[model samples]
Target: MSYEGSFRVWRGDDDAGGLVDYQVEVNDGEVVLDVIHRLQATQAPDLAVRWNCKAGKCGSCSAEVNGRPRLLCMTRMSTFSPDEVVTVTPLRTFPVLRDLVTDVSFNYEKAREIPAFEPPKGVAPGDYRMAQVDVGRSQEFRKCIECFLCQDVCHVIRDHEQNKPAFAGPRFFIRIAELDMHPLDTREGRAEAAQDEHGLGLCNITKCCTEVCPEGIKITDNGIIPMKERVVDRKYDPLVWLGSKIFRRQT
Candidate 1:
């Protein structure tokens, strides 16, 4: 049940670093985080990795496992063979602050860009009620733990560093979609802002963000595509165009 697992963990800070090989003890029914802790205890005492609530709910232990963004606590050691060298690396999309931890402040910056949910002026906190079906739509997106895996995996900002400024990435796309879908929300032109400002158009529906989500959120299918459809409906539909023009004249 116990074996020496070959691990190649990235070591160093923002200035410079490389993958340092380590032979760590692995046990049955253990996750990657366990192996990492064992490595810290035995071999690499100075290793830098961030983790909390090792139960996978805190979203604090995100890293690239064999080049895929995943929660270290959720990825089981059994997924890889004993002979296979497991490569743990910092998220390539963000600036590396240390070993497994990166500067995730970009996600916080993107979070700041999002406007909070705006309810109609007349509706009191307790007086408002929404249908079960309507509430279900936004509820799915609320499950996000702010892990930033979706943002890290998104190619718009991941592959192209320049796109970071314009693109809000999948996490915020779902947030915007949640607010836009809320029946009681008074916000207008959400779809327009999604397309024009947040760089929603950059997404090609590849669903990479959905794949890496530990919560199994249907980010692309449930959120992004619906918002894309809304954007098309608002922009290209003749009746909507006419209504917009008339509303412009009235204003």
Candidate 2:
């Protein structure tokens, strides 16, 4: 069935902005992004929406639909009644560049702060080996498309901008977790990075980030919790502390 509806899309740049309603016709199996493109073609020629692969794989086209973080390309128009108006707004966590476009530079800066992987030295390029079970742990986190939806929904950095400086959000926590779990990684700073002010401690584990993840990454359970466990082990485990000391003496 075909239905005509009005979409109230937030439109503007840094100086000023407001919601501009546009009328569009929707067909069965149509997604919100489909209707948005119609508006761009007919009503607003300059309407800016960032998107790469319309197919849900790109992780782009993220926005807030009726106040919830979601990927426009994945949200079906069928979910809402034709009589009801759908509101599309840019992600609330980042600075607005224009209609449906937000500056996500903050994420890049935080990423730069994370220390890169430092594998054990003297191992030949193909000599490093790891058990399948150990390698499997990080595979889930590797699914992230860098959509930043997890970053946008996270309250530690979303609602509390003040905490941005000290919080790495869920995305980078996954990175840190992946690196920390790597069998070949000789880096000893995982515990320190996780304990830092801008680390895992800031996360209240609200799970909002996980809900909006396009790749269905288990951000809170599989990633954040394991990293937290590592931090706890390093800071409080007497056995590990004593073992490390003895191992150091023997070396």
lDDT by residue (1-251, candidate 1, tens digit) is 99999999999999999999999999999999999999899988888899999998999999999999999999999999999999999999999998998999988898898888888898888988888887899999999998999999998889899999999999999999999998788888889999999999999999999999999999999999999988987876888678777776321
Q: What does candidate 2 score on TM?
A: 0.93
Worst 10 residues of 2 by lDDT: 242-251
lDDT of each: 0.92, 0.86
Q: How many residue pairs of model 2 clash at the backbone?
A: 1
- Model 2 / residue 204 / CA error / Å: 1.1
TM-score winner: 1
**What does the lDDT read for residue 24 in candidate 2?**
91
What's the lDDT for candidate 2? 0.86
Ten contiguous residues minimizing lDDT sum, candidate 1: 242-251
> Candidate 2, 49: how far from true, in Å?
0.4
List candidate 2 stretches off by more than 4 Å: 124-127, 243-251
lDDT of 1 at 68: 95
Residue 18, model 1, lDDT:
99
Q: How far is candidate 1 from the true structure (C-alpha RMSD, Å)?
A: 2.7
Task: Tell me the lDDT of model 2 at 141.
Answer: 86
